[model samples]
Target: MRLVVCLKAVPASTEVAMDPVTHTIVRDGGDAVWNPYDTAALEVALRLKDEARAAGQEGWVGVVSMGIPATASLLEDALSRGADEALLLSDRAFAGSDTIATCYALTLGIGRLCAEPDLILCGKMAVDGDTAQIGPMLAAALRLPVVTGATTVERHGAAVDVEQVFDGARRRLCMHGPGVVTVDKDAATLRMPSIEGVLAARRTSVPVATAADLGADLDRCGLAGSPTQVVSCFVPERASDAVAIEGTPAEQAATLAYLMGEVLA
Candidate 1:
């Protein structure tokens, strides 16, 4: 089984700022961490790989991400967590890519990483974006079947069984791979890296690719290719005030009623 997991480096701080002119999030000041949901996806892939290997079958897990050069550290983190290899698609041309352009670059990058991967996995959403669009969009670009919000997964040959929860309901599905799945947080817990894995990851230099390396069309890889435009981004102002009516139950109820009537009138 050859599996690939999509990873992301998101801002670690909740207090993120926006560029006044560009309307884009300011990402330079704070540290970055792996997207929370992607951790579950990675855990799922690692378990699947272990199962395949234990069955005397070949299993490989590769992690891929599209981000700036600094994001390579995130790939190394995935390596320590048990991925076999890591690839980073980083180029100045890929800066400011919206969901569409991001998926376009990833599609080409994944094609370069694995010619015929059995399964592709991604987090249901990235915390920074919260759009939950990358997995389905990448699947559409790759022309493969996709299942999103997968809470559990089991593989049998080329088929996969998936369970998901939606709108207070649970649904199970069976799908065939070469496909994509966006794993939910409920899927599995991420495992800690062993000392050996940590040392190995420290020595392993993740391969970084650029748009030219992936043969990406420059016109469709970044801001130029992004159709969605952010008109503005700012935190809404908030007001905090408290009023108390101190009296017996009946008096309090009468006061509340009077206040409501006055406000309505």
Candidate 2:
């Protein structure tokens, strides 16, 4: 059996700033880290591999990440954490990709790496985009069954079961064959890398595949294929003012309420 996990590199800081002129993420000169949700997805794949081994079947875990050339470091991190293989999808033409384009490129790359994976995992959402759209999109494009927001997963024989969380309920999903699932925030965290693993990961030669290598259509793998367009992106100006409340405590409370009502109205 083979398992594949999808990953994204996101800004380390939560307060990621946008470029005032370009209206795009200020990705330059910022520390980039693997998406937290993707880490959970990796952990899920590792655990599934362990279970499969115990069941007398061996499984390999691989990861696929798409971004600039710098993102190869992101895949190395996954290798350090114990993925058996990693693939990087980097190309200039892949810039400014929306979720649709992203899913297309990812599915193309993953399909090349693992023609028939027993399972596929992804984070419930990317920290930067927070759209949570790629997992299902990839599944649909590949014509495979999918379930999202999985907090727990179990595999028995050829069937995979997951505890899927929705708005106000948790549904148990069972798939009889190869399928995809997105790990929720509540999934297990990954273990830290060992000294030897860290050094080995740095030496891991991750192969990069471009749009041509993945056989991705030029029009469907980048900004040109993206339907969503950004009109503008700028931080909202903060407005702040202080008002003095001159009176007894009761009167101050009443004045505060009145001011709040005015602001709300």
Candidate 3:
């Protein structure tokens, strides 16, 4: 079985800068970190790979991401965590992609994998975008069934059982293979890389594919392909409500005690 996980490299800092004209977050030349939710998805993939191997089946785990050249580093990190191969989709033509366009480019990249993936995994949502649309959209593009917000997934015969919290209840679902699962952050814990794994990952070269290599139409990628545009991007001003007790430590403590007593009374 071939399992593929879609990874994302998000800004490491909370204070992200956006392009005023494009209204897209600046991703180049910044320190990037793995999306925590995607990390959990990768963990789930790795566990499934282990199970497949133990059952004497062919198991391969690969990771794919779309970003600038710098994003290759995150793919290498996935290799360190036991992914067999990594592919990076990076091209200037892919800049300023909305959810639909992003999914379109990703669909092409996944097609370039050595073999058709039996299962595709992704985070329920990316922290940066928080749109939570990629998994379902990618599944649609691939003509596959998708289950989102999955907190647990396990192989069951020819199908997989997915469990998730829905409508304030835990629901389990069985879906056949050649499907997609959008994992919640609580699905699994990412394991630490071993020393040998780290060394090997450092030596592995991640392949980069561009729009041309994927035979992607210029009209179906990047801002051109994106139908939705961000009208505005800005941090909302926060209003604070609080009272400050100004005095030395003892005075402040007494004032706090009196307030508590009053409240209690």
Q: Could you tell me which 10 consecutive residues in candidate 1 have the lowest summed lDDT?
A: 21-30
Ranked candidates (TM-score, high to low): 1, 3, 2
Model 3 scores a TM of 0.90
Model 2 residue pairs with clashes: none
Q: Quickly count the clashes in candidate 2.
A: 0
lDDT of each structure? 0.89, 0.86, 0.92
Q: For candidate 1, write residues 51-124 as lDDT tens digits.
A: 99999999899999988788888888899989999999988898778899999998888888888999999999
Scored by lDDT, the top model is 3
Report the lDDT tens digits of candidate 3 across residue range 1-265. Answer: 7899999999988999889988888897587999989999999999999999999998899999999999998888899989999999999999999999999989988989655898999999999989999999999888999999999999976789999998999999999869999999988999999888899999999999999999999999999999998878778999796779989999999999998898799
Q: lDDT by residue for model 2 over 1-265, one digit each (tens)?
A: 6999999889988787765643457665358998889899999999888788788888799999988888888788888878889999999788778889899999888888788898899999988877889999989999999999999988878898899878889888888888999998679898787788789998889999999998889998667878885657556899797899999999999999999999999
Q: TM-scores of the models, in the given order?
A: 0.91, 0.87, 0.90
Top of the candidates by TM-score: 1
- Winner on lDDT (1 vs 3): 3
Query: TM-score: which is higher, 2 or 3?
Result: 3
